[model samples]
Each structure stands twice: as C-alpha cells, then as structure tokens.
Target: MPKQPYRFSYLLLTRLLLLWVSATFPAQAQSVYTQETALARDTVPSFKRHLPWLAAGAATVYVGGLVYLNHTWYEKEKTRFHWFNDSHEWKQLDKAGHFWGAFHESRLGADLLRKAGVSEKKAIWYGGALGFVLQTPIEYFDGRSPAYGASFTDIAANTAGSLAVIGQQLAWGELRVLPKYSFHRTPYAPLRPNVLGNGLSEEFLKDYNGHTYWLSVDLAKFLSPTSRFPKWLNPALGYGVEEMVFNDAAANRTLGLHAYRQYYLSVDLNWQAIHTRSKFLKSAFYVLSIFKFPAPALEYNGRQGWKMHGLYF
Candidate 1:
C-alpha cells in the first residue's frame, strides 16, 4: 500500500492490535481452569536458536517497508520538519482507532515474545509497548514529511494505548476488560465511494463511519466467585461516529450533513475463556478474538433516536 501521509501512517498499530487482541498476555497469566491449557501456554522453552533469524527477518522487512513508504512510494510529499497536529479528523474516529490499534498491538507483541520463549517482564516491556514503538517510527517519518506534521495527540494516544495493556497485564495478570472492534458497512460509503470505500481494501481503512471501538468487559474476572455469570461472556460498551463525509465541521457543512456520535451496549463473547484441546484452534481463536462476535445490541445516536440491533458486528 502507498502511504497517504496521515491516512495510512498508523495502520500498523492495527496490524499489531489484531495480532494480539485475539491472543492474550504472555507466559505469566495462570489459567483458572483446565490443565491442558497450562501445557499449551506458559510452557514455552527458550528459542535462542530462532531469535537471530527471527529478529533479523522482522527488522529487515519492517525497516525496509518504512524506507519504501517514506522515500519511495510517497516521494513527492517532500521531507521537512512540521509541528504538532491534533488531526481531529473523522470526528476523532481516527483517535479512537489509534487507541484501539495500540492497545491490541501491544498485547499481541507481548504474546509473540512469549511464544518465542521470552519471559513475562521482558515481553511486557517490549511487547506490551510495541504499539508505541510501531507508531513512533511512522511519526518520525511524518515529522519530516511536508505533507503532514508530527502529532503530539497521536503520540500521546499511542502511549496511552500501549500502557492500557501493559498496566493491566502487570497488575491483574490478565485483561479484565478487553478493547475490541466491530464494523458495519455505512450508507456514506455509497455517497462518496472514493472517500469512504473505493474498494474493499479502502473501506476498512478510510470508512470512519463504518468502524466501532468497544470496551468488552469480562465480568467473570471481576465478579464474585459465587456469581452465576458465565466465564465466556462479556458485556461491551462501544463508541462510533457518523455523517463525517468530511473530517472537519466546516467542510462537512458544505455537504449539509451533520456529524453525530454513537454509543452501543451489547453482549460479546470472550472466546479465550472457552477451553479446547487443539493448540492450533486456540491459537486461531486468539488471532480471531479481536473481533467482537455478532450479538444483540442497544444503541443511542447523538442525533437520531435510540435503536436496537438484533445482531450487530
């Protein structure tokens, strides 16, 4: 993908986010139930032989991609120092995206280290904070790019995102409330396909109205042991925005459509809580877990009245 300056600079955070959001923390988190689970996880031996090739391979590809995006693909954008930009585009949907991306990515990074036999502390430091590391390099490129300035807000959000995971893992040894994401195709994509979704690829990236970031609380961890709640269930609170044909208010007014914030209450599944024998299936589930499994939802829009979904993703 070609870099669109501010547009695609931080998408890697999402890559990292999904990578781990499905997977939980490193080797430290002790499972409450099932012995087979323990054997599959937390039993990783040292991977010293693999580390050299793994590290070198990852660095080469990542650094090479950075150089290509900054100097080659987006060459015309020019290189020059720029000031802080809040962006505040897509009605702060991008900011929420950053938070969601960083949070998940940090956890995923930690999981990778754990899979490679790294200890909890080192994994937490590097893996849990990988979101910030992943983001800063792009920010470094942006700071030097004339097309977009380095955004202090973005940096702060990325830091907070990484910390949100690191702090929880260190304190609780597991996530009590996980950050999850869901998206539905919006009507606006048809109104302005170029801006919203020219293709399936662009839709997920640029269609702000199509995205929702959620805090899916695992009450099983927080509730009393005597409580009847199922361990596999989660209640989700979600945030989204719509009518953002333009990123700014004045620009959106030209289209005569008002922006509105959206809130959702829904049930979600904590797939990790479900026990299974196959390590491969568990691993697949962990990778797939960043997505909020479809469920019923109650929603309130800032402009429109309340609505309910029989099933919302």
Candidate 2:
C-alpha cells in the first residue's frame, strides 16, 4: 500500500510538470478561416469580392433611380432643381474648359476606385472611364423629362468634367485631388449687391505618378469628412504625413519636389441657398422625410453643396 501511494504521487507530479512546460512555450494560435478572409476581405467586400452581387445591386439601383426620376417628373412631381445649370456655359472638346472639367471628373472617379480597393493605375483609368460613361445614361434620362429637356451642352460638360479629372491625374498623380475651390449658397445678402465672396479655397494640389500621391492636410478638412462620416463620403483630412504609396521607385526619387511638398490653405464664404420643399417625385418615397429633395442643409461644405445641383447627383 505504501509503495502504491508513492507511485501514484510520482505519476501525478510528472503530469503536472508536463502541463507547466506546455504552458511556458505555447504554440501560435491559428488564424480564423472564412470565405471573406480567404478572399482578402477581412470585414468589407473588395471591389472584386462579391462582384456579382454589387453589379446586380448597382445596376438595379442605377436604372431604377433613372426610371423613378423620369416617372416623377412626368407625373408633375416638380421635384428637381439645377443650381449651376445656368451659371456655366458649354464648350465642346476643343475648349480648354472641357479639359479642366473632365480632369476633375476623372479625379473624382479615381478616388472612388481607390476606396473600392483597385490598384492606382486601374483606379485612374476606371475613374476617368466611369466619369465619361455615366453621363450618357444621365443625359438620356434628362431628355425624357418634360420639365427638364436634355441639353447636349450639359452632357458635354459632364464629359469635360471627367476628362479634366483624368488630365489632372496624369499631370499631378502624386496628390489625390479634391475640390480646392467651390462655392455653396449665394450672395452674403441677396438684398445687398456686390458681395462677391462664396466659399472659395486654393493652395491645394494632388499628384499621382501611378504609385503615390501627396496632398495638403490642413486644406483637406473643408473638402473631406472625418472617419465618423460614412465610408462612402470618403472623408480625408490631415496636416502632414506620408500619403499612400503605390510605387517605391517613383516615391524615392528626388525630383526637386519635396518627398512631401506643402501648400497654404485659403477658403472664402457668402450667402446661403435654401430649398424648403421636396421637389423631385422620388423624394416622397423616402421612409424618412429627411431623404426628400431640397431638404434643409444646416451645415454644408462644398462637396455636399454639389449635391444641390440636381444634375451632379
């Protein structure tokens, strides 16, 4: 009985010692496996991830929105407005204005592509192409609306805006461009004439050499939203930092420009354009009244201000 007790104690001690050793040198835990993770979408879907789903959804919504817009206008919903339609004149491809406009649109498209996880080159190309292609469909809808006749010049402007964006990417691919200058609202006081200020900003630049782009952070504030904003808003703001890089060789080269250059910030402001009622027929379909067109905008930067222009949406 005494021998048997000793043997049991020794066995117990050995087991305890083994457990301690195992605890001291633990193995690395295996990563979780899932389709989204395996496909490189940790939490969100990539542009390529679930592409069929997105394609179906985007196509459905885009076409549906167009049809709805037309239907409502046809039914006399009186729910559309164009703040800038009359302010700008149209010039075709030969016009310098066309180039600038298209360049801007391309930049906008590229930015969207980057968020969708596309490579920078693809982003720029896709953005420019999207900017150009999106206009035709929009123009078709406009032509169908009795309240709003399709203007060839307007479609041309859209194309020009997109081309301007592409040109900008080609010229300055280092910084991701944002709307550096734009005006929201109207005269400071409509009763008071000659008040010319209306939310203007300058000293901003974006350059992309296929790999990296640089932007002034301080100025990015008025043009971008914060992280809390919806990802779709694509909020961006910073003071000074190394921007995203797509090419190591291009970023490392010293071309007289600072590895990261700097720019001053300037912005001006004036009156407000307030719309009191829902103008578009689609506005009434919103579950919440807030979704209606011409809903009050308590605070707006120029980017959001662009939404006020019915054609831009």
Candidate 3:
C-alpha cells in the first residue's frame, strides 16, 4: 500500500520534468515547420516579390542584343554625313546666347523625362528648364573641341527644342497621363539655312520666316549587373523631320510661300556609368544613340546633324 503512494509521486515527477524541458527550449516546437520547409514543402508566397525583377531581366537580355546589332550599323557610316553647325555654338559669358542654348536642350530634356517615367507637367517644364541650364557647359566644351567650335545657332535650337517639348506636353492632356502613346505625335520642326533665299540665293529674296522640328522615339531595356555599373545601356533611335517655310518677296502675293521637307534619323547609346541611380546622371546620359541615318532629301544640305559617340552617366 505504501508503494502505491510512491508510484503516484514518481508519475507526478515525470510530468514536471517534461514541462520543464519544453519550457527550456521553445524552438523545438517550431522545428516541425522548419523541417517541412527544408524538405521543399513550403507553401509561403515569398517568391512573388521578385517576379517583376525577373521579367525585367529577361527583357533586358533580349533587347540588349537587338540594340547591339543596331549600334554596329550606326558606327559604320556615321562620319560621312556629318554637319558643321558652328552658327548655334556660343560662349558662356554671353547671357543672351546661353539662354538660347539652354532653351533648345530643355526641349529635348522634356522628351527625355517623358520617356524616363516623369509626369507630363513636371517632365516638360523640368526638362526644358534643365536643358537650358545644363547645356551651357556642353557649348563651352564645344569651343574647346578641336574639330567643332561654338555657335549661337545651336543654343537657339536647344531652347526652341525645349519649348516645343514643354508646349506639347501642356497642349496634350493624355500625354501627361500616358507617356508612351502621348509622345507618339510625331514632333516636327523646319530647319532653314540662315541664308536669305531658298536654294536660289541668286534671285531677289526677302527676310524669310522658317522653322525646323525634330522627332525622336526613346526605348529602354535594363540589363543584369555585370561589373561595377548596372549591366544595361539604353539605346534610342530617333527619326527627325525637317520642314522649311519661306516667303518669296519677288513674286508679290501670287507666289507667297516656298516650302521644303527633309528627313533625318539618329541613334544614341546611353549608359549610367557613374552615379547611375542619381537623378542628375539619369538625366544626363540616359540615351546612348547619336548617329544620324542618311536620307537622300537631306543630302542637298550636304551635312549631317551631331552624332552621339559616347557618354558617361
């Protein structure tokens, strides 16, 4: 009978020991979950977060290959049809000249921001403003380049381009909301020789009013990281449209207008090498293509536009 009491005591002690063991190591309870996961039976949704980057990676590879092939063609014959635009180049200290230079680049800057996911209002105004402000150094650099010098005409064109970009964004409502399609409206401008006549300088010509509009399409593909910089360079191919409208003073009101149309295309390859994530670098070297495509119509002018050889962002 005394043994029966001892047996009960032993049973109680056993239960107490188990309780203490469980309390001492709570992780053992979670072991089952970890083991199941280790066995590849996990049902959690962790992979969903990385899906977008994976897709971007695959697309980058495909597009990078295509861009490389196009780049080769641009290099082969870029120098033959080159332009000497000394007229637009200007000095930095010259206040009026600097503003014009900024204006032209700003127009292009708006187009850049639109492509890089900036909203229409900010993209246009900000881009135009930046273009004018930032391009001053480039003009100054041009003065130093051995092959090319500075010109006031280039600055003016830059300003015009900037205004055009901002104006287009403001004028079109959907463009602010939807960029890809909004920028599709072929941007156009006319380029006329600073001369007084329309290819007939011999004839009596009057002060003419002419214009030039440039259109460009921007495409991008992000690549996987290879070395120090991100492994992608976004290259854009731009097709240009040139139109000129001049007045004929000699023919009275009967022959009032003279017009000319020319076509131009350019390619640029851009890489964000230094400060790739920085806002300024992104804005600076965003597009890498800068070789103009040859067109028979533009040949009459005898020179191609500026070519983008290489850039560091």
lDDT for each residue of candidate 3 in 221-292, tens digit (9 for 90 to 100): 122334343223322222222222222223323434333323333332223223333434443342221111
TM-score for candidate 2: 0.35
Q: Which candidate is the best by TM-score?
A: 1
Which of the two candidates, 1 or 3, achieves a greater lDDT against the reference? 1
Question: Looking at model 3, how many pairs of residues clash?
Answer: 38
Q: lDDT of each structure? A: 0.71, 0.33, 0.32
Global local distance difference test of model 1: 0.71
Please identify which of the two predictions, 2 or 3, would achieve the higher TM-score against the true structure. Answer: 2
Candidate numbers sorted by lDDT from highest down: 1, 2, 3
Error of 1 at 156 (Å): 1.0
Q: How many residue pairs collide in each prediction?
A: 5, 30, 38
Worst 10 residues of 2 by lDDT: 202-211
Model 2, runs deviating above 4 Å: 1-47, 50-52, 75-108, 112-120, 145-148, 175-177, 180-265, 268-313
State the lDDT at 291 in candidate 1. Answer: 78
Model 3 Cα displacement at 91 (Å)?
Answer: 22
